[model samples]
Target: MQLKIVLAVLGIVGGSAIALAQTMQSNHGDGMDHVTHGQDKPADAFGLTEPGQGAFAALSEVVRFLEADPETAWSRVDLTGLRAHLVDMDRLITDTVVSETELPDGISALATGDIETRATLRRMVPAHAAQLMRDGRWAVEVSVLENGMELRVTSDDPAVVARIKGLGFFGLMASQDHHRKHHLMMARGNDVHAH
Candidate 1:
């Protein structure tokens, strides 16, 4: 519909805005590097290096096991990695807040002109989400307890999710296809941006 197009355009423009701010940082993973951390955000967890490398690395084995056993995919995966993987993203999003009183400890320089903290993050969301999409790994958490593994697509931060979804890369993984190791599962949102 027209609405989708308008949002898409706005998302593109928002990305441009970040570029204009010159605050967009690049830290792409070469797909081959399984255990490395982004220079932007260093490894604060186990010696795992990359935030969720262990979880993503486990996907191939999980898929192979699933292919071998028709019904054991959910049971065979080392659920710890996937759960821990999503948790890392959750922590990152939670730590990202747009507050007038508090600028994120190390990101103030990324601010555009004289904008306030919230406005700066709002302007930066599109670019940040895109960057996160490129580097942040996601998965469909499946298990034997019920029938599937589900994450609350919508994060606690609506604004951040909206920006991510607006980028069209949202919902990158809302399916059961385990063939590909990385699922670009998106953060859900009620997008309200207009072109």
Candidate 2:
């Protein structure tokens, strides 16, 4: 039973790696179809397999998906919009200075940066707070200040409160699996932020 569970978990995790590898292979047309040919190729032969940095890897994945789809509307594809969103993410991660305060229920985080970063914070924090609220776990609130953005997260359960404090701002932002689907939609010219 344990082995079966482990295999099931691995299958779920490995599915993405397999899809990525196939996408990379198809994009490159390297004449080596490992899935079909059963070639015992060295893993290193597939380049770094790191797929570059975070934003680049994400854009690459989106592009690969676009390329793989036969019905993809190239005319409707909006990579520029996707790139802008990725830039906002980069600013959020690299530019912001975050100070976290412990709260009885969870934590309060004030994230500050330059003009661009502050704008990013104002735009993203509340959106993420809304996303967190949907899980029915944590109560997240956001305030946009002149120089910074403030996020307050709390929970009813003591353990969840502890988890909220541990996660702080960034981990909370990274919590959901909706990001991948959101990116895909954005790349396909859909306004994911539209209410």
Candidate 3:
């Protein structure tokens, strides 16, 4: 029984990874496919919420600068450094897999596998995304319950949830959500609930 359980977990994880890779490959060359959604449109104003320093703060600042003055942002911001930050984000996304023991007390112990950080991010974006962009310390916790994988965004900031509902889901947040979700969901599919 133990062996069977382990095998099943491996299968699900493996399948999710394969699916994610295929999805990314399909969307890679299509440039305009991203724009039709209008998610990348520039914001004319900056956020009023007080932000603390971290990845989120940096991202929010850069986004404000970009939207307020795209010409200057294009000229002043370090595009290469931004790309490196994204690469770091990629690593953070994949590494966020949770373990079975981390589940709550009542959840059935039978189901076991990653919650796939990228997957949940697609269906429902983290409200504290700006903070996440600034610091990878925060994570979306996924618990392997018997019924399904429970997904929740866990952040140190108490204001994250409320702030997410506001008008700040801009460029950094958009790119992180789309790209990360594309990778996580395509691979995981609805793998979270499978027995």
Per TM-score, the best of the predicted structures is: 2
As for TM-score, the candidate ahead, 2 or 3, is: 2
Off by over 4 Å in 3: 1-75, 95-97, 100-195
Q: Over 4 Å off in model 1, which ranges? A: 1-68, 71-76, 98-195
lDDT of 1 by residue, 1-195 (tens): 999999999999999997766543334334334455354554443345333464455444444445566545343344444444444434333443322211221111121222232332343333233333343332111111121111222233455445334432222322223313432121111122210
Q: Write the per-residue lDDT of candidate 2 for residues 1-195, one digit (tens) a residue.
A: 999999999998899888888787575455554465436656346465457888898999899889989989898899888888889888898899999999898999999999888888887888878888897778888888879999999988999998998787899988876888988998998878842
RMSD of 1: 24.7
Clashing pairs in 3: 16-187, 20-187, 55-134, 55-135, 56-130, 56-134
Per-model lDDT? 0.35, 0.85, 0.42
Clashing pairs in 1: 141-149
* Clashing pairs in model 2, backbone N/Cα/C closer than 3 A: none
Write model 3 residue lDDT over 125-145, tens digit each, in one string. Answer: 333343344545334443444
Quote each prediction's TM-score. Answer: 0.20, 0.74, 0.21
